[model samples]
Target chain A: MSKDKWNDEEIGHWLKSVPKPEDNRSRDDILARLKADPRLRDKQPSRSRKWIPAGVAAAALLAAGILIPSLMDGGGEVSVSDSASESADDAAQTTSESFQSGRSIEQNSAASDEEMSLRSDQSVMEKGLMGAAVYPEAMEGFVPFRIGLVHEATVVPVTFLIPESVVAEDFGSVSPGDAELYNRYASQIDEEALGFDDYHPYQGTVSTDKGGVTLVLSGDHPYDTASASITTFAESVQETFRNEENVLVRDESGAPAEFDQVGALPEIATEPEGVYFAYEKNDGTTVLAPDRRFDPAHAAEAIELMKSRTTDLFEPLIPAEADLIVELPAEGDRMTIRFEEPFDFSRMDDQDAARMIDGIALTAAQYHLRVRLQNAVNPPAGYQLEDVLPLPAGPNGIILSLPG
Target chain B: MDESVFHRIYEEYHQDVYRFLIYLTKDRMLSEDLLHEVYVRVLKSFGNFQGKSSERTWLFSIARNVAFDHFRRSSVRRKRTDESFDWETEQPADRGLTPEEAAVHGDDMDRLFKVLDDCTEDQRMVLIMRFLQELSIAETAEVLGWTEAKVKTTQHRAVKKARELLEGMDGWGGGGR
Candidate 1:
């Protein structure tokens, strides 16, 4: 079986020997999936049945093979025009193609599917960014502005993509830096609209120089009301400007600002530690937070712990219905998650599934590991199933204030 | 749209496209996802598929685009994060199977499969389309959005590369020891 070179005939023989695996789904199963795809729901015949409004929390549901056509409002790797799935892939596309023409289901007798490419199921919407995390694959032509927004007790890091068009129109040609992001749009956010309490447009000028970020607070700033208030402010600052090593808080005179409880603040190190779990509040704000009492021995433990509630406050990222088998490589940074067969990911709420995937990736990052998901019904966008995927740029993805 | 027409077109071509995607992505789950996408797009734009080309060829082209789009997005993301990772130049561990997998698929098949994974994307695609899926040079060109000459050239190189690597393997019996 050894030779300096094999012949073409032999190569063809071997190539022909390569196995052809059959899709396990029946035609009925496939048709059901196609019909249930909220992305294609308009093309479906109107029947006296429940139809999930496209992208109504259905962003990442197109790995859809089993769910009866429900609703779609979230984005995953599955894009649905611009108004379709709020997927990272959609966000990465040229910023003008919106796919909200489902109402007409126009007779494009002359238009070919090639016209839209295969991007129908994967566009970024202004609505819900399905899982709200920037997989490494998101934002190619766009710049990502990642910042931590304060939500009462937690610091939530979210990403906004600034399209090139906006960059060109607003800043001439060059993309602006992350430091400028907070200054430009921090005050513009209606924190309550984004499910966070009113916090931004901090009562100060934040400048990042070689000495680190300098917070020149206006005298009337109420950050010194109590110890808890100062702590929240410090944590928010730390989370927001995690890139800088030292943060200095000063009064308008540029001297160290004093609080009644903590006195003058020292030069702060910008570091946020520990992993996060999806926590839902009584008011319905579901953000990622770390349990004050729960700490794991390692990343594997953290990932396992994240599957279920660590406390009453924290909800699991991975759903209870998925009886997934996770295999951590004894060495190396790749984790393998094998799902039990007959699992239809589209059946779960898109937001839940997305958070679960992001939560797993974020947890794996605690040990510098990337997850390689296996045997998923429809693994959402922001994941490359064959490759070990890195964690999303940040959690709670938002496209707020695409600065122009 | 009548479901029967879709069923017929699907019955004929879904397996071939699925096989092609499996060969291209080398992951069953991913292939399934891409397969769904292909049909989803196909069904949505089915009215416009005017038989300008044969249904098989059109379907193959759609399938190729679906696969290509997936790869392009993935590679684009990688390039952003890891400066050194260039999709055009990256040799991959796409289908490297474990001992259990090799035993299940047979050592020779697994070896060939793994070796094929290392081939350049163009060459690998040409070889799979030309030989395994049995698309002609013309159809392969159409699917790849390339010319027939490029298809022939890539098919030749893909086969040569695979053969050259296999000659050095221990149990490959194709070259007539």
Candidate 2:
């Protein structure tokens, strides 16, 4: 092995050994940066509009397009103009000249503009509805009174919708986001009255950034008693944050959260498990719950699994007298469940029926099936059950709009 | 473009492009900044994509252009003439000690990249796309807008240059595999 005569094949193999660098920033972070750039927006075609709210996008345009162009106009450390000045014989654009532009005039410090717009992107996100975490469209204009309710050992999430009118009373037109709402109302939520385990305003600091929520759990945070507790805590977080996809669980000192049994956990990815069933809170309040650990075989098996009481933890969503048959769609993805007797959801409480509908729809969703409930058409969550019901955006929704 | 479509493209290609930018710039913050530029340009001009090249190659082309633009804008132009850009991208940023650098300190790769720094821009691009990214010779040619022969020639020269540089250092002693 002569060092002097090392071959190309050896070099090629060693180059492959250079490990691919880790990219930690989430998709949301990149999107935030994209939304923050005005050049993209200025060139955006009209048909592609309205994905983001007009107000947020306008604010983004203002921050990126305005307020900082002159500040960076040749005023920064020398990266652009001074360096390229030495190159007197800069060649013609032989490659990708279509994307290229005049060096000096076009170099308006776009990189510096990026840092500015990223800081403003947070303000853009905070302007979105506080309850966008659960269902953005349905919960917009209402602040969330979210509580992580305990049902047996399961953490059942319940969000009370705080109407904008009520928010304006104290905060005056500027509705406080999750942190403020948590601070102001969390202590007062009667957990015993709500039938929860008194876990309100999580014993942690919840903050937001370009990459979704960062939950800083306290030293004695109570989320990690078991795998069930971990699942619920993490899932409950999904229901609580604006963007559930990127919840980073940090310790008190901001290191990635490490639980007692589970050695080290960096972040929580909230994915729906198999068939959801009914569970009752400590105060006998019923909520749709999923056995997050269980993996049901298929849609039919899930339907069967949902009917029988799994344990003291999970109860049957379907009534004991009700008998239903899972009817697979001929060509489409929607599963049809036809009921024989006691299938009338009209007899159940409106909210209970809603939860049942939600649970069934959610179970169907786990197997990539949309549910078209044949007999339960007029179930109480306000959507027409006669139609093919898509998966519920979430579970256990209860709005608490302040009275006028 | 639909945000969902943009998001899909971003998810699929963002990591590879980010790593490519990091290898080009060696500074995480600058890579991120350049990544932003790449994505912004991508989203703006995505409608123009003709689908002639694979989506991966298309993204790499855009990323290579973005890195080149950053060099043109930044002080990297001072090291060489317009035709030959001697990439002076030394000293990875302290903020993000990439897992690659942290895990492979004093390894062959550490020395390889150091030697690669002395290679020309064309050679660097060919070596990265061909070997690091595992793209074929034709795909690397598509990204750099060069003929396959040119890509092969550059790759050969780049590897030989890297070996020669490594041979000069006392400790290299010619690695076995």
- Give lDDT per model, in order: 0.58, 0.56
| Least well predicted 10-residue stretch by lDDT in candidate 2 chain B | B72-81
lDDT of 2 by residue, A129-234 (tens): 1111133333444455655555333556555555465567758866566556666656544444333444556778877666766788899876764333465566
- Among these predictions, the greatest lDDT belongs to 1
lDDT of 1: 0.58
True contacts kept of each: 0.58, 0.51
DockQ in order: 0.21, 0.18
- In angstroms, the error of model 2 at B115 is 62
Q: What is the per-residue lDDT of model 1 for residues A1-404, given as tens digits with 9 covering 90 to 100? A: 34555688877877787666667878888788667554344432322122122322112212111110112222222334443233333432311122222211011111221221223234333234333445554444445666666554355665655445555676675555555767865665544434454577678898876777788889988676533346557767766776677688898887898887557875555644446677653234465654323335666676666666423335777766667777878987787877776556677665566667767776676566788777776644323356666655556554332322
Give the DockQ of candidate 1.
0.21
Model 1 Cα displacement at A105 (Å)?
25
Q: Which regions in candidate 1 have their CA more than 4 angstroms from the true location?
A: A1-131, A172-175, A281-297, A308-310, A319-350, A366-368, A374-384, A401-404, B1-177
Q: How high is the lDDT of residue B79 in model 1? A: 48
